[model samples]
Structures are given as C-alpha cells and as structure tokens.
Target chain A: MPTINVTLYGDIAQYGSGKQLATLDLDLPQDANIGLLLERIRLPSEERGYLFVNSVLHDVPGLNASHNDPLKDGDHVGIFSISHMWPYQYRQGIHLSDTLKAALEEKGVMKNTYRE
Target chain B: MARKILRIKMDDLSYKYEEVPSKWAKWGGRGLTSNIVAEEVDPTCHPLGPNNKLVIAPGWVSGTPAAPSSGRTSFGGKSPLTGGIKESNSGGTSSQKIAKLGLAAIILEGMPKDSKWYVLVITKDGVKFEEANDLLGKGMYEVDEILWKKYPNKPAIIGIGMVGEKKLSNAGISVNDPENKPGRYAGRGGLGAVMGARGVKAIVVDDTGGPGVEIANMDLFKTGRKKLTDAITSHDLTKPGGGLNSYGTNVLMNIINEAGGLPTRNFSAGYFEGASKISGEMIAETVEKRGGGMTGHGCHTGCIIKCSNIYPDEDGNDLVSPVEYETAMSLGSNCGIDDLDYIAKMTYQCDDLGLDTIEAGNTIAVYMDSGALEFGDKEGALSLFDEIRQMTPLGRILGQGVKATAEAFGVFRVPTIKGQSMPAYEPRAIKGIGVTYATTPMGADHTAGYTIAPEIAGVGGKVDPLSDEGKSELSLTFQAATAFIDSTGYCLFIAFPILDIPEGWAGMAESVAGVTGQSITGDDVISIGKEILKVERDFNTRAGFTAADDRPPEFMRYEKLPPHNEVWTVSDKALDEVFAWVNS
Candidate 1:
C-alpha cells in the first residue's frame, strides 16, 4: 500500500473532511490511478472542476482525461468543485501533466467549459 | 444627434464645446484618449506639469441599453509613475452618465492659475466650476459622500484622495460605484496625480433628463447584443452561479498558487504556504458564513458577468466591496499576510486613500524585504497607511511606488518593469505573461495582455506555461485584442467566452459597428488595436523610451524563482518582436 496526500476545495470538501479546504492522506494500492483515488474519496468525477496532481493541472471539469494517470507513493492530488474555474489568461503557460497536454491537443482549443 | 466634446481650460476657468474631428469620429475609450494625447501633448512634458492634459472618454457603445458590461470610462494622461503614455479605465456609473449627457470626451487643459482646487459639475446645460476648499485634503470615501449629499440628482462622482492631492506617483483616480462607494478606481500609472496637479478635485456628472446616446442601427445592435448576451450567459466561467459569479476575481489565488506563479513575499519565491487562507475559496466561504457580505456584485449597472463582491466583517458589516486576486496576492501572500480581514481593511484603506492597490501592496512588500518591517506584520503594515496620510518624509517615499521605495531602501531585488511594480503573476514562472509585462506600454500590467488564458486555462489554444516557444506571438495577439476590447467599453472578462465562441467575438465588433454605423470585421478590430498601440509607442519613443525600456527587470533575468526554479528565458529579440509591427 502507498499513501497519497489529498486536498479538496469548495463544495467537494463535503466528500472529504467537510471543510472549505480539507487535506487528508489516504492509503492506496501501488496500482491505483486517479480514478481509484476519486472513488476511495467518494468524489464523483462529474462533480470535480479542476484536478491537480502535485501542482500540475491534470483535468478540468468536463475534460476528464487523467483518470488513468498512475498514482505513485506520496503523490499529492488537489480536487475542486464545479464552481471553481481557472481562466485561460491567468493560468497561461502553467505547468500541465502530460496526460492533460495530450487531451487538450486532441480537443484542439481550450474553452471555459468542455462537452463530449 | 452628434456627440459634443467638452473642453475645460483650467487656466482661466473657461469652457468650450468642439465638434468631433472627422479623423477621430469613430474613436472612443483608449483609442480616442491615446490619439488625443499623442496629437495635443508634448511627449517630453512633465506628467504633473501644466503642459500635460488629462483626457476622459467613454467607449462607442457606452450608455446604450443593448450592450452588456459596456459602461467603462477611460482616464488618460502621461503617467508620473512610468513617465509613459497611459490610459487607465474603471467600471462605474460615470461612463454611462457622461455618454448619456451627449459628451464624447472631456479634455482638462492647462493648470489653474489660482492655488485653490475646483470641482467641475457637468450637466445637460453645460459645465460649471466651483471652489473645492471644503472638500480639500479629504479621503475619496468622504468626498463621495459629500458630493452625493450636495448634488440634487444621483450624479456619478470622480475624485481623488490625499495621495493624489500630494501628487504622489502611486495615486489613482477614484470613481463611485452604483452603491455610492468610491471603490471603483482608474488605478494604474498615477493618473490621479495628473488630476491633482491640474487643481481639479472632482467631476460630478448629472445625466438626468439629458440627451441619451444615439444608436445608428437598432436592428444590428440588437442582433449583436443578443449573441453576446447568449455567449456570456452560457459560459461556465461567466454565467450565473459560474466560477466568477461565485468566487469573484480572488478565485485566481489557488490556481495561480498551484501553478507556482503567485509571486509570494516580494517575488523572492513562487509559492506561499498561506495562500489558501486568503484565496477565492476562503473569501467565498467567509462571505457565506458572514451574513451581510455578498458575491456576484456588479461594479456598474447592466453587467451580466458580475465578479465583484462585498466582503463583510465578523459582525456582518461591510468591510470592502472587492478584495480581488491581485490585491489579495499583493497585500496578502506577497507580503506574507494570510489574514483576510486585514487584507480587506488594507483594500478599504487603498480605496479611501485613492492609491493603486497593486503598487501600494508591492511597495509595502519591498519595504518589508528592506527590513523596515517583518513579513506578515499586520499592525506595522497598517501603520504605514497612517504615515502616508500624515505625509511623513518616509511615507512620501513609500507613496511614490515600488521602484522608488526599493531605491530608497537600497534593495536590489525589485519586481518592476518600466518603473511600475509587477502585478500578482510572477514572471519567471510564467514566461508568456513575462513577455506581456515587458512589452506593454502600461508598465508591468497583467490585463494589458493576459496570456495566462492560453498558457494555463487552454481557453484559445493550449500552450505550456514553462515553454518559451511562440510566446511573442501569443502576447502580441492578446495585446492587440485587449486594446480593441478596451475601446468597446466591455469588461475584459468577455475575452474568456469570446475567445472560445466565434459568434461572441463577431457580436462584439458588430455591436460597436451598430453604434458607429460603420462596417467592422475581426480584421478591423486588430487594425484598430494596432493603431492604438502605434500611437502610444510613438508617444513613448518621443518621450525618450527605447527598446531597453521594453525588457523585463534585470533582476528577473538573473534570479531563479522557486517551485519551478526558472528564470525569465524569453530572448531580447523575442521581446522586440512583440512590437515589430510598429516600425513596419
């Protein structure tokens, strides 16, 4: 088993420690991915707005492409509620996970909200 | 009805109405102001001297009912802070009021011969000047209250505080919001000092029963307005209960912090441990917990994407109207102060003092870095405002802004570009915005060209925030687009949806065309933006600014920021390439 630090923000905190910001550490199997971690925390994928794996953006609300990203020991995951948003200009040139980069490239253009 | 230009000569208390010059017939906002300054003002003239003139103008669609969030007013003058051509705009009732009064622009010319300050009252009849002895040396909050009570109709009030009256380089002009709170400010480049030096304390615009703004094509205007409205209302970030409406602009704190570009502790580092405490999530939570506060408050009437908020004290009393992300970062994390209440109080103090919050916060952080006070010294930080109010010699240096304060304290790691302090974003961590900060005519401003959208949010196209590739073109595109958007009197937030939705962008241009009765396309918008930039750059060139001025602070090139440990890697040639179109 491996432990991962998780911080939940906004309305999604109810799924964790029930505070505006909840930071907790969870033990997971080595084979666990982001999807399994979300399942363990009881946070539905549809309810999450932004997902950050160790300060690098991995998933936006509608663009859920990082579920298969493998979790390592001591990985930090930050999740926000649907009300949270990261506007393009403010976050321009920000670091992104490889998973997110490929997903965004497939989508071609970045929008405030995404639909399948 | 043709809109009239109101010219007030302060030298002898004279006024005249001039017809719109045919060359400038379709110009408004920054486009009009920059052109007027370039044409009429001597480039080498002192910003606070008699040779400098202050020009105020609303956008083409301002005061029209069909356009949402089109009530922005621009204040232009040579900035005492940056010694460059500057146009700082704010959202309030003044833009709509001035437009409804059938005025295209108001030019304040020549310093007054008399020592006494005067207030200008603009109405349907004409302009009247009254002595402002009673209102002298007052804070903007007090001045707004006095003017509101004295005036018959609920007129829009524009005034300055003691900082402006003293002609400090960091002072900003204050405009009263719809709630009569003097929190809305044209808060960059020290334009307030220009207003103060001209011996004008305030301008009251009474548009009651005045001739309203004339719309040339009602059908086109309606069509464009509907498309824009739909785009704004449907966007997840701007629509009702969306990110902005729920958290206000402070929402950027966490995301920027997460991205390691928050500029914590005077730009010494990229991350702040206490960022979450003062973030948008915390602000929204506090607003809900504290009963009297509200989210989604509009700065002006008819704003569909309401991102402003009213922060309340523990007792449910109003603390501040908006504690935005830039202010929170500057006054909070940048200074190492995590307390939201203190940040709100500092925000209120900046509003009342008519000081640019970003500059003031950076100055204090620089002072803290200089060993004057410890980081997160709440009481010490609060006491510095008293020094400014009392006009102590030390206070004067702090009020002059970050560069001045750093020089005064012999600190070498100053985070400024072109003599103006950098806003919230740390340039080393985010290279694209670094290009924008270096190249914009307005010194170190984020809103000048917000590349963070494509780099971070993937709004237009995805770009790696850490990569330096194609950053020059990214900044150039955003800068030109921003210049055009600023001219339309629309809030810059519209860029989010418009960038993603083609119809929204088309609607923006169409709405302006409908008002001016001119055919406008996307190409026309880009050209107009480029034209404005040319006028401003030409003025700066004449004022003795060189390509050297369009580079990042020397410290940025050498200092490595943390979390990423990256230095400003954009090439000098790349920086110059941003405005390569100027010479062409």
Candidate 2:
C-alpha cells in the first residue's frame, strides 16, 4: 500500500465535512486511473477540500490520474482548501485584487502551482 | 495649553476634565492613555469590575487637518479578555470628529444597573445623553444608518455591537470611517463588552451645527496641514499611488500569507495552501468583476491616506472589513474557511453583534477542534454567531471569550495567553510578539509591542521575522517607541514609513511638538514613554498579578508548530529580564 499525508484548509481541516482534505494509502494496482482515487476520497462529497499531488491541484481521481500522468513510488499526494479568493466572487479582502488574481491564475495558483 | 487629562475615577458617572500639565501633552497618545489608566485604574482589580475605566483619546496632532494626523484614536481599558490592561486604536471618522468637538478624552465609568441603554452625543454645544433603547439589539450598520439619518451631516459615531450588549468578553468597540461603514473597530480586547456591561450603546461626536475646534493660528494650521498632506502624498506608503490608499488593508491578505507569518488554523500550520485564492489581489478583482467596487475610502477627515474600504454586494450592499488580519486568520484560516465572502459575512456579523472578530474566529476554531462543530461549515459558523446573539447558556460561555469557550468544552489546545485570543500572528512563528503578549501591561496584545516594522519591514534594520535573536529587546524597543507614536495621536501607519527610513522615527517627537506647539523633544519622548510603561506595570502590580501570571500558554512550549518544528522554549529567565527592564 502507498501512503501519503493530506491537509485541508485551516478553516475546515478535519474529516467528515465538505471541503475536507484526507490522505488514504492506496493499495490499488498501478494500472488504476485517477478516477479511482476520487472515488476513494470523500472531499468531493463535502465540497470542502481540493485534491492535489505534490503541488499541482488535480481532480478526484487524484494526481497521476490522467493517462498522460502516471503515479510513481513515494509520490506525494496533497489536498488543499480553497483560498480566501476561491469561487472568484468574494475577494474583497487584501490580496484579492484583479491584478493579483491574474498573477495567481497565471501561476496556476488555484491549480497548486505557486509554493511561496 | 489645552486640556490633557480626562479622568474618570471609580464607578461614579461624574468625571473630571483636567490638563496634563503641559509635560504630558508632548507625550500624547499611548503614552498618555497608559499613564492615565495606570494612575487611575487598579491594575489588579477585576477587569470587568467597577475599578476599570475605558479611556478614548485622539493623538497629539489631532484636531488639525494635518494629513493622516486627524484619523487616529487611542483607546485604553482594563481587558475583560486578557485579564490585564488593554489598549486598542483605530483610524476612523470619530477621532477627527471628537477632536473637533474640543474634547481630548472621553471616559466611560460605572456599570448601569438597568438592561437599558444610553448614547453619549458630544456636540459643539455639550454632551447629551440620548436614551438608546430604540437602537437596542441592533448591529453597527443599523445604528449608523439611524444616526446618520437623524443627524444627517458630520455625525461621527462610535457604537458597540450586540456582543457588547450581552457583555461578551471578546466584544470590540465599532466606529464608522469616512465611508459610513461600521467596519473600522477599536478591536483587540473586549472593550465593547465593558461598554455593554455599563449599558452604553453609542458615542456620536459631531462638530457641525456645533462650535468648531479652535486653532492656534489658522494660517499656520493651513500651512502645517498642507506640508503634512504633501508629505503624505509624496510618501509611497500614504500617497495616492500607494496600494494602501487605493486598495486599503485588504491588500495584506496575500502579502502576509506570502511572508509566511499569517496564522492559519489555530497555529497548527504555517503557510495555508489555499492562500493564493484569498490574496488581497484576488479580492479587488472579484469586487470589480462582480460589479461591486468599494475600496480605499477615508477613515477620517482631511486624511490623504484612506486605508479603509467599503466592500459592497452586486447590488451595492455593504459588508465591512471586520475583515482585517485578525478576522482573516480567525474566521478564514482558523475555521477552515477558504472563501473570502463567507469570511466577510462572519466578520460583518461579529461587528454587528459587538464581538471581537479574532475571539469569535478563535471560538469557532476551538469548537471545530473539539468536535462540537465540523470545519468548513460556513452555516455552522454563522449559526454559532447567531446563537451568541440569543445569549443562551452555552452561547454565554462562548461569548465570554475564547478562553471561556475552550474551558467550557474542556479543550486544551486553545491558542490564547492571559485569556486573550492571540491575534493574526503565530507566536511560535513570529516569537517577539509572544514576549509582548506576556510582558506589556496590556495582556496578550500584539500592537502593544509589534516588532514587525523593524523585523520584517526593516524600519531599523532587516531583522529576521523568524529568528529569535534579540527578539525580546526588539519587542521592548518596539513597545516603547510605539507608545510614543501612539501618544502623539499620530497614525501608526505613518510610523511604518518613519520606522522604515533611517532616523525617520527618531524625529517624531519634534515633528509632533512642532504641530501641537507643545515644544517636546526626543529625550523627553523616551522618558514619557518609560513613565507610561511604569504606570501600566504598577497598575498590574497593584492588581496582585505577579510575574508568575505573565507566561504564554504551556501548550505553546510543548506543541511544536509544523514547518518550523519549533516550540516556545524561550526561558522564563529571559522573560523575567524584561520585567526587570521595566522596573529598571
């Protein structure tokens, strides 16, 4: 079985809720697609957490779920909550300006591309 | 030459207005409030008892149309949340209005016996106590709208929210800025709760239709104001070109997050992964794209640096920035809330309900940690805020502040010191503020000793934000210097630029005296600040709180923060050194 740590956004980091992050060690065969991991994690049901691997955000099938992307051993699976700028509708706080948004989206911020 | 001391002794409603004997006015602001509070208030008394008095005063350079000078207001009161002295300040329309009315300070003493309310309206004529029961059970906006409608023009109002009305320990006093938004708060400890216990709802000071303030020389005042405004306009921080003036403080959400000091999720993590989504840049874009653009408005009159915003809905409905750092961290990161709108709603509710955003955010986080509520449940958080308004038995305990909430639920992982909820910065992460939280007369206050200017921004040197080297001394210097700036009634943001430039802040005393005609100097500023510190310390000492009670929570020492894997291991010996310095 492959094991990895997962984290949810601070406001709702625990399990059993929408927008939650969790890491489940997968025992599925190497040939399994990304959809299998999405079925495995409960985050989508709660709409609380986003799924990511390493740094790049991915769908429920989990990272390497794409046919073009393949999971390797010791791969890190990461889950992140939506940023305060999520939904792109309520960014009235600091760092939510349009220029910041363009910069973030350009850097694939919501897609988990920016680290710092 | 003007009145300096605004004294309210004991529980009596009778108050005295006296001058600070010329010497103290030179050291106005935090220097003044701390001195007065320490002299008049028993530091050891019950924070909510009859002994504690809430003191509100404008800066030394107030009343003049001198750029950012008229915006700042200094507030000091015994903290119901921290169980020690508390001082919180804000930039809003109220301070200028108050100064214009020819009052130096407004003190609220004595708790009213009734469940009724009284509103203090200080006009040019005199102070009028208007019965405020009709404005009862109202949020800040409702009160603002009513008062704005009734008074029409130049009605600068400060009021408490529902949280204070119920006497919750984490309540904060709310004031409307130039934007007429009740989001600007004198928030930190539960000062509003204290006002609630005393049955005071609102304080409105309007100089219009009243006598205007007296200036030493109108020509000199105009020239002084123009010079000051020009200076502000030229400086990038306060200038029109600055993002702060254009976007207000909402711009810091991403910057602080990027800096890695933004507290996320009750101090369990350092760099919230969802930070990019909530950056200030994103907020401004959404405001425009969603057809709701309200940012960068004035908090006071004749202020060029308008760092206050009025966030509106698609239909132009307002939601306040009760959405500052404390609110962002407390409601957004601590509670697992990734969405900014949800955070803003909770923030607005806190302002309306008379609750401290930080405390309320921390309270919800505690509940999430204890299994009482699920994380990321926006509705649940909203419900908790609503429940607090009903004042249920459980709600009352929650309303008592984060410490009480954690105590009631038997949760030991709470992040509080001296019963006050820690502000936006993680102590283990920042470290120096932790020392201030423990030592400053005001319990667990971050601003009392914020080293961020020198440490992170290099107002002095490029001090490392993360390292522990000389943090104690750094915090000490920050506290003392900040007190001096605070007393001058100079806005702290101005202090930011001053601290940044070489020897910029050093000339602050002369600049203040130059404006106020008080003839103060640098050496005098230092002594006055020290005097203020001594008074605050003596107040705490008389209140029976010894050095033993000044430590941070034990968990901070044992529990290692992730990313850094560091605990608060700064020895008590080191902390004791600060107390000795205070005595020395």
DockQ of 2: 0.03
Model 2 spans > 4 angstroms off = A1-116, B4-27, B113-115, B209-237, B314-316, B451-467, B502-507, B521-526
* Residue range B374-448, candidate 1, lDDT tens digits: 999988998899999889999899899999999999999888888999998888877778888999998899889
Among all candidates shown, the one with the greatest lDDT: 1
Residues forming the 10-long window of minimal summed lDDT in candidate 1 chain B: B450-459
C-alpha lDDT (0 to 100) for residue B399 of candidate 1: 90
**Each candidate's TM vs. the true structure?**
0.97, 0.78
RMSD per prediction, one decimal?
2.2, 10.1
User: TM-score of chain A for each candidate?
Assistant: 0.93, 0.41
